[model samples]
Target: MKKIGIYISGLGQSVHQESIEKYAMRIKNELSYNDTGIQYDIKSEKIFYTQDRESTVVSIFKSKNDSEQELVYKLYDFQYHEILTTKFKTKNLLVKNLILFGLIIKKLPQIFLRIFASGGFDRPYLTFYAFTLLLLISLAIIFLIPVSIETASQLNFSVTIPEDIRSILENVKSYINHFLPISCIFAKIKEWLVPVTTFILLVIPESKTLITSLATEFACVDKYIGNGEQSQLILGNLDLLIEYIAENEPDSKIHYHCYSFGTIIAMDLLFPIGNIPSTNVRNRSALLITIGTPHEFINAYYPRFYNNRSPIMEASLTWFNVYSVADALATNFRKDMNRGPAEFGIKDVLLLPENINYEITSDKKMNIFNFFSMNSIRMHKCYWDTSPNGQSCIRLLFQKMKQQDFI
Candidate 1:
C-alpha cells in the first residue's frame, strides 16, 4: 500500500527543499532499523503536481520479505514565518499596533466567554497569564505618554510633585531654571517627540525584534485559536492538501506528522470548528505523530484559546505524541487535563515517562536568563536527536506505527 506522510513544521521553521530532504533521510534511517523485518528506503523525492501544483512529495520504497511498496511523504507548507518575523518600519506603526493590541486584549474576556458558552472550550477558561502579559504591555505603552514637564513650567504653574519626589523635582526644576537657555531648547522638542524618541531608542536596538515577534505571535495565536483570519488561511492550505490526496491518491494511507506549534494547527485541522468545518481527511488519516507538542502549555496559560473538543471523529486514527521530559514546551498527552485516551476517543501513548530525564548540557556559559533564553527553548527542538529508553524518538515512532498496523 502507498503511504503519504504530511509533515508540518513549527513556528518560524518554514519547509524548504533542503529541510524536506533532511527530514526524508531521517525517517528513512529511523525506519531502516525496524525489528519487524520491514525496511523503508528513500528512492527519489520531487515536487508532485496536484490540481494545484503546490505540493512536495518524497517517494520511499517499503520492502518486507519479497514484497516491495512505495510510500510518499507530503510537506504541508503553510507559511506564517513572515508574519512571525515581521520588522517594524516606523515608530508610529509600533505604537499604533500596541494600542490596537491593547484594545484587543481589553475585549478578550468577552470573546473568551462567548467561545466558552458556545462549548468550544472546557472549565477554568480564564487566560490569566496571557491577559497579564498583554495588560503589562498595554500599561507600558500607556506609561510612554507622560505630561510635559516643560509645558507645566512654561505655563508658570508649579506642578504638584509627590511628597517623596518633591525634593528631587524641585532640585531638577531649579537646575533647569538656572540653565534657562538649555531649558528653552529642550521645551521646543514636542511632547510626543520626546516620548517617540525614547520609544525608538528603547525598542530599536535588540528589543524591537523580540517585541515585534511576541506581538505577532500573540496576534497569530489569538486569531488561530479564535478561528479568525489566520485560521482560515492556514487551514485552507491543509484542506487543499487533504483534498488533493483524497481525490488523487484515494487508496493511499495518510499520516500526519506535526512538530511544536504545528501540532496545534493539526489539532485544529482534525477537530475543526467555526469557519473551518469537518473534512473527510480525518477519516482518511491512519496515524498522527506529534513531536514536541505544546498542547498542554497552551491549555495551561491560554485556557480559553485551547480546544477542549473531543476528537471522536478521529477515534480510528492512531496518535503517537512524543515529548521529552526536559522540554518545558512539550507535553505528554496522557497527562493533559482536557485530553486523555479514555476521555477522548483515541489511543494516547506516553512515549516519554516523567522519570526518564535527558540531561540538558551546553558549551556556552549558563545564567538565570539562559533558562528563559533560546537555549531552554531549544529543548523542544532536541526530540529529533534525543533518544528515550535508549532508542531514538524516530525508532519509537516506527515501533508505534508498526504496533498500530500502520507500517
Candidate 2:
C-alpha cells in the first residue's frame, strides 16, 4: 500500500476536530477514487484514520508514532493544491478559514463566557453607576481648583520643593501672590470639565473598540521588550509559546520558530552560559527566525542613535529577518550596507509592504497608549489574512518549511 500522511493544524476542540476530520475524509475519498491502489492516513491532536483497498485502519494511535503520522499527513495535505494557488482561490480560502476556525476553537470557552454574561444587567448597570460617580467627583474637583499661570507653576512644584530651597523661596512666594487668585478659578473650571470630556471620549464605540484591540495585542507582547517593572512578561510569554510547541509536537526533532523579544529568551535556552546549565532535551531546535530584533541598545529617537557591537547576531545557526519598510524599530545602519534580493552574506531580508503609519504629536506624546494608530491594529494582527498572492502567509511559511523538509 502506498502511504500518505496528513497533519492537522490549529486548536484542538470538539467542533473544530469534527469539521477537520470531515474535510480530511472528503479529501481522502477524492484521492482514493482518483488513484486505485493508493492508501492514506490522516491524524491530528484529536483524530486518526487510514484508508486503502485491502483494509482500513481507523483506530487512534495510542503512542507518539500515532501523533507523528497524523502530523505528517496534515502537513502533506497543507502542501497539496491549497499552497499552490497564486491568489485567494476557493480551496485556499477554505483551508485558511478552517485553520482560523481551529484557532477560534482554542478561544471558544472564553467566547461562550462572554456571550453568557453579555445579557446580564448587574455588571453593566454597576459599570455605568461607577462611571457617573467618577465623572461627578472629577467635575467637583475641577471646579474647586484655580488655574492661573503662577498658580499652575506653584502647584506643579508644591509637592517636590521644600520651603527651605533658599534661592527660589522668595521667587515662589512672589509668583503665587501674583497669580494664585485668578489661576485658582480658571483651574477649578477646567478641572470640572476635563472628566466630562474624558467620559464622552471613552463612550465613543469605535474609539473604544480600536483602543481595546490595540491594548489586547499590546498585552500579548508587552512583557517581551522595553524596560520597567513588567520586563519578565516577555520571558513568560516565550516560555508559554515554547511549551505550547513542545506539548503539541513532542516528537518534532528540529523545531524552528521566530520571535522579536522571544528571540532573546530562546537564544538563552539554545546557548546557555555562565552558571546556567543547558536544557539537555533530545529534541533540539534547528532554525531561529528573528524579526525586528534589537541586537544592540540604541537611541530611541530618529536622528541620534548608536548601534552596539554585539556577538548575538553571529551565533544563530540559521536566522531570517522579516522586516518592514516603515519598521523604525529595526533600522539598518551597518558600516558596509548591502541591499537587494540577497545581501550581507545572508539570503534575503523579506520586506513586507508598509501597511500602517503612526503619528506622534506634542500633546499626545506623554502617554504610552498614544503611540499606536488604527492602521497598526489592522496590519500586525492580520496574520490569518490572505496575502495578495491568495495564500495565507502563515500557511505558506509552513508549506515552504515542509517542502525544504525543515519540519
RMSD of each: 10.8, 20.0
Would you give me the overall lDDT of model 2?
0.32
Query: Which digits, one per residue and each the tens of the lDDT, describe model 1 over residues 115-156?
Result: 445233222222333343445444445443322444444453
Local distance difference test, each candidate: 0.54, 0.32
Per-residue lDDT over 1-407 for candidate 2, one digit per residue giving the tens place of the 0 to 100 score = 11222222211110122233443444344434445764555554422211211111222221245334332233221111111122223333224333333333443343344334533211222222222332333333333332322344456654665555533655654665586665445556566456654554554335433333222222222222222223333233333434444454555443333323333344444443222312322233444444333222112111111122222333324444443222322312232212223223111222211111122211122123322232221222232222222222234344444454553
lDDT: which candidate is best?
Answer: 1
Pairs of colliding residues, candidate 1: none
Residue 109, model 2: Cα distance from true site in angstroms: 44
- The segments of candidate 2 whose C-alpha lies over 4 angstroms from its true place after superposition are 1-70, 73-206, 209-251, 259-268, 271-277, 281-283, 291-316, 326-378, 386-390, 399-403
Q: Show model 1 residue runs off by greater than 4 Å.
A: 13-18, 35-53, 62-215, 274-279, 306-310, 334-375, 385-392
TM-score per candidate: 0.58, 0.35
TM-score of model number 1: 0.58
